[model samples]
Target chain A: MSGNFIVGQYIPGTSPLHKLDPRTKLIMVFAYTIGLFFLPTWLPVLLAGIPLGIAVYASRLPWRYLLLGLRPLWILLVITFLLHLLGGSSTAPPAPEDVWATLGPWTITGTGAATGFTTVLRLAWLFSAASLLTLTTSPMMVTHGLERLLGPLKRWRFPAHELAMMTSIALRFIPTLQEEMDKIIKAQAARGSSWRYGSWTRRAQALVALMVPLLLSALRRADDLAVAMEARGYQGGEGRTAHHPLQMTRIDRWLLIITALAGITIILWRWA
Target chain B: MNGMLTLRDVHFAYADGTPALQGVSLDIPRGGKTAIVGANGAGKSTLFLTLNGTLRPSQGEIKLDGRLMTYGRRDLEQWRRQVGLVFQDPDVQLFSASVEQDISFGPLNMGLTEDEVRRRVEEALIATGTEPLRNRPVHALSYGQKKRVSIAGVYAMQPDVMVLDEPLAWLDPAGQQEILALLAQLHRAGTTLVMAVHQMDVVADWADMVIVLQAGQVIYQGAPQGVLAQQERLLSVGLTPPWPVQVFHDLRLAGLPLEGEPPLTRAALTEQIVRAWPKK
Candidate 1:
């Protein structure tokens, strides 16, 4: 159950990608995502996976775990792929040789297969790139990078520091809250509250019971955390120095330049 | 008496008008271990809050090193910097994902330079013996490790006095000893240590001064030796005398000959009994 929630799961390492500035990775992933939309054909989509593949390799993340993390998303990816496979474009008819298979009123064509395969590949690349960012960078570093990126917006009255702090805190408590919930569930189960074998309405009722305690505990925790924060001299994030301050190193700079060049090249190719 | 922190006639009430602290006055000795013991409804936690400037006393005042504490924004920040508070539950205090980052929060909020914050974080991690867990996520840690990281968070601020609310609560015996050792280390380094604890044995073994609270008022405040000798007074306040004290009292009541005051700690009791044993 816990393995599926992989977005914020960080694996500690000293690989070059792990050592890169989080801001660099953030920007690279952002540009890569936008470039992914510009790639028109299956060939360009496959081409786009090259940099992502290199990133995954550089991250030194265990391939088994990385692949396992994508298990939950396979359902969505398969659904999208199947939709495109069965629902071919209405405007153009494929060459007779392009006909692949026919099932009850639905015809599978080469173009449909290409579109489905390309769409799945694009989505996989997007997921992998995003996952790689989190896998290498700690949540604190990500928050630090985000705060630095949003520093300029402070002039416009943006509460960037507070937002980052909140993000970091939320990330910290995710597992704690989860553990609390697990305990509550086991406690409830011991009290003869069947969570697994309930009717739809019964399940809803049981969930309400579970949710009330979770929400109440969360609120209590929030109150205690606020007190703790205040006792530690937290005052609105003003004048606070970051322990892991974000600074772009030479490698970070090179990575940024390479990502920008790749993005522009993809845009030019799509335009041409 | 003058000490690191002096609270005079401090009274505090919740927003709902329930009094948590009522006319509480005490002094926490400088560079000394002061333990506050009380029942569940007693205001030990409330008093710690007032000490750290988290809750302003409704009526009376608190002084730190001969200076009256102020509630102004800047003053409160400075006050909190000088007096760090570690809550009983590490989950509440550990707000950062990583141990190092959590420890860094206090020093960072002090507006120190990045290098200085890093130094302080490293020092705190080493002090609490949580250096290896610095990069680990807070939730991944065991309860005892989380407890140490929480202490490390407050220690990074390098407060003149550290106040802990039930620092040993819910810990195993070995973990409690480890924390007590950590506290002793901090004290040896010149930081005043004040804690509200329930373990009577810990209070007797560790605290130089013991303050017993009943219904938000101080029932007794003095040396642990003097306080632990009065078993009835402690029991009335919902606190039992330390085990050795109880045994010492029982021995005297059973018509056994024992000299001097009752031993406040196990080692003292054992030594006294050994000395009183019949000759071979």
Candidate 2:
């Protein structure tokens, strides 16, 4: 039952992508995602692959591992592709110049396949790009990076530090909660709760059984954690200092420049 | 009067109106291995929370280092740093997935520089013999190892006094010895330890002083030998005298002349019997 819990997706390494400032990687992933949407055609989407490959290389994680994580998305990828293919653009009529083919009652057109291919590319790349961020960066680094990026909002009275602290605490407690959940499940199972074999309604009842205790225990743990954090001198977001301060490096700037150039190149080529 | 912690009629009650600590007063000595012993319903956990203001006492007061305590933000932040607690369950005490990160949590909260926190983390890892596991994830650890890492997290704070709730619970005999030895090492280094323990023999063997509680109040406050000697007195409050004391008492009842201060520990009892062989 605990097999599904992933405590940390971070695979620790000193790879360039891993060493890049999380803020830089975050913006790169964002810019890359936006570029993915704006690329005009399949050719431009293919051009976008250059930067995606570069990201995969820089991350230094196993290419197979990165791609393997996308395996579960194949179903979504196929569904979107089929939807685009079958449901093409609503139009008054297909122009004679538009390539078309008839398959019995269904008319398959060039625009259908093209649009389907492009949408599949974008969705798949979106997942891969996001995976790169989560795989290479530790959750704590992501929190700190986001907080530092949000630092400017401090002028507007935003509690960036508190939000960041909450994120870090949430990441820390993920596994603790997993362990507690595992305990509750096993306890229930020991008390003769049938979790594996049941009708859907019975299973829903079993789920409710599991959820009640899990929720109660999770609340108790949260209370304990709040008290523990307070006891550890967590004095809110005001004047609290960081031990591991985040500092950006030249490599981060260079990575951002490269990502920006890639986005521009894809746009120019697609428009041309 | 001035000990590491001085509680004066400290009282705590739940929001639903059930008392958890009832006018409990205690003076935990400055730098020794003091044990708090009580049955399941005793106020051991409640008293522990009061020491660091985790759950503020409902009434009365506590003093640390000869000064009265307050639960104000700044006061509590300072007070908590001075008294670190290793909770009974390691799963609850350990927050971070990374062993090193969790150990660094307390010291980092102290507003220490990264270098200083790093140093203290190293010191704590070595103290708890968890240096090899510094990079391991918390969820991957065995129960005994997790307990050690939990202790390491608190130890890294370098508190003036450490309070551990049921530190020996769920540990094998060897694991128990390791923790006791670790506590002894800390005591020798001038860090006082106040532990809530259940085993009467452990109280007799390891503690410089023992505090016994019953139903949210202090029943006995004295040396383990002095308290355990009065078996009938202990029984009324839901405790039995340790085996060594019972053995000595039965021998005396059986017409043996072995008198002066019955042994408090098993080792002491064994030594006495070995010496008294070939009875005159």
Candidate 3:
């Protein structure tokens, strides 16, 4: 239930990155991620890390939060690095030509270790850049940007408003659901339902007992919310206006221009 | 005056063929505070659900203001709007993200404008004394605070009659006093109140009328004093009289000349004790 667990977790600050329009941030994140994919060498990857470092600094979010966001991908990073290191040079022993160093009892080669380090560094840059985008944008604002960016699909009867509303509800309920899960866990602990020292089947049974109540409560909440929505005169997406409109300011334009230039420069410097 | 609610020959059973309410009939007068006292599983909650049209009886009619409430979509919605029900668990009643949003839910459903909804939210929060908790998260509140928020959520709807199920359960002494005072205030404001309570002292001091339910039937219905005097009937229905009534009974057993009627309030009990003191 900690609020930090949510995606698009905005740290409240008066920094310029926080003030940029959500649309600009969303576009910049997409462009930056694609630009990272095309960097083929360690020099470009390290160069790309500079803008990401600036974004992290400008957002005023603590470095620890960005690292926490990468916790889920740590195992994948390890696997990729190990695979590159072990497979980068798969051949018969080179006739003492490729071996770079020899000690009294061991030999050091050139190919594998460098490739592994470069791959790990590139992956780290990719994750940190993605995390920076979420740390600076609120979920609602991100959804608003999505609605605006998807506005052209309205001519094809895509139901942009409904989609946006659905996204907003999903975003709003993530923390609520996590809070409920925590309460359920505590309630089960009070009941002496042991999640430790149990066989797989017993643990599964205990989990079912805990999950049933939470699911029932969630369903009841959903029913109540539907009734509440109807009572509040929330008819389907029609004739409703937002309380806070998403407006682009001068800072947003500057941020967008800077991000676009960075992305174009990275691509040109690498491939052009 | 016609009663606010009238049930005649109402019969209900669960889908598993267990009879919850059988031949239950009662009348609750308008502008009167009524307490429905019963032991657990004695059909008090089932009866409240019936009143709000959530459960329709198998063989009876419910009349509100002389109009029969049929089990239909539109009629049920109207009935629900007229009789706001506060559930036993505050968690179930309050599902909104914020207290203000939860309180404004019922008013908003009634098709009030944004300004009207805001006004009612403010008024309900002030009425329940939960104005300061307007922006707090619902799950972060304590049990007693959540109970008050639930009541405020119902109050925002401005129902003619408020039906509360076990309103005082799980509350400490101060919480109980606050809820009792809130009920009294609501009653004074001309809102008909029907509550299911287990505490006999609350019934003695606050209820104008008392209904005792045993095995899903109306076993007793009269003024609070009258009901408290019927010790045999109360005991049969698994209910005990208030403490003052017990003291009055003990005095009667001690050969004191009792007054015309039993006392139902602290002041009345004290005055009766003073008057019944033997001449020295």
Highest TM-score model number: 2
Q: What fraction of the true interface contacts does model 2 reproduce?
A: 0.52
Clashing residue pairs, candidate 2?
none
**TM-scores for all candidates?**
0.92, 0.93, 0.75
**Could you list the iRMS of every candidate?**
1.1, 2.0, 4.9
Error of 1 at A84 (Å): 1.6
> How far is A24's C-alpha from truth in model 2 (Å)?
1.4
Better of 1 and 2 by lDDT: 1
Binned by DockQ into CAPRI classes (incorrect, acceptable, medium, high), candidate 1 is medium
i-RMS of candidate 2: 2.0
Tell me the alpha-carbon RMSD of every candidate. 2.8, 2.5, 5.4
CAPRI category for model 2: medium
For model 2, the superposed segments whose C-alpha errors exceed 4 Å read A1-8, A96-99, A102-106, A262-272, B250-258, B271-280
- Compared with the true structure, model 3 gives a TM-score of 0.75
Clashing pairs in 1: none
User: At residue B227, what lDDT does model 3 achieve?
Assistant: 83
Residue A17 C-alpha lDDT in model 2 = 88
What is candidate 2's lDDT per residue for B1-280, written digit by digit as tens? 3487898998899899889899999898888778898888788887887888888887898999888998887788788889988888887777775899889988877778778889999999999999999988787898899889988998898889999999999999999999888888888889989999887788888888989889999877877778887878877887777889889889778866675788888888887777665583
Ranking by DockQ: 1, 2, 3
**Selected candidate, larger DockQ, 1 vs 2:** 1
lDDT per residue as tens, model 1, B1-280: 5588998999999999999999999998888889999999899899999998999889998988879988998889889999999998898898777788789889989999988888898999899999999878788889999999999999999999999999998999899989999999999999999999998888887888999998999988899888888888788878888899899989878766777888887788888788766621
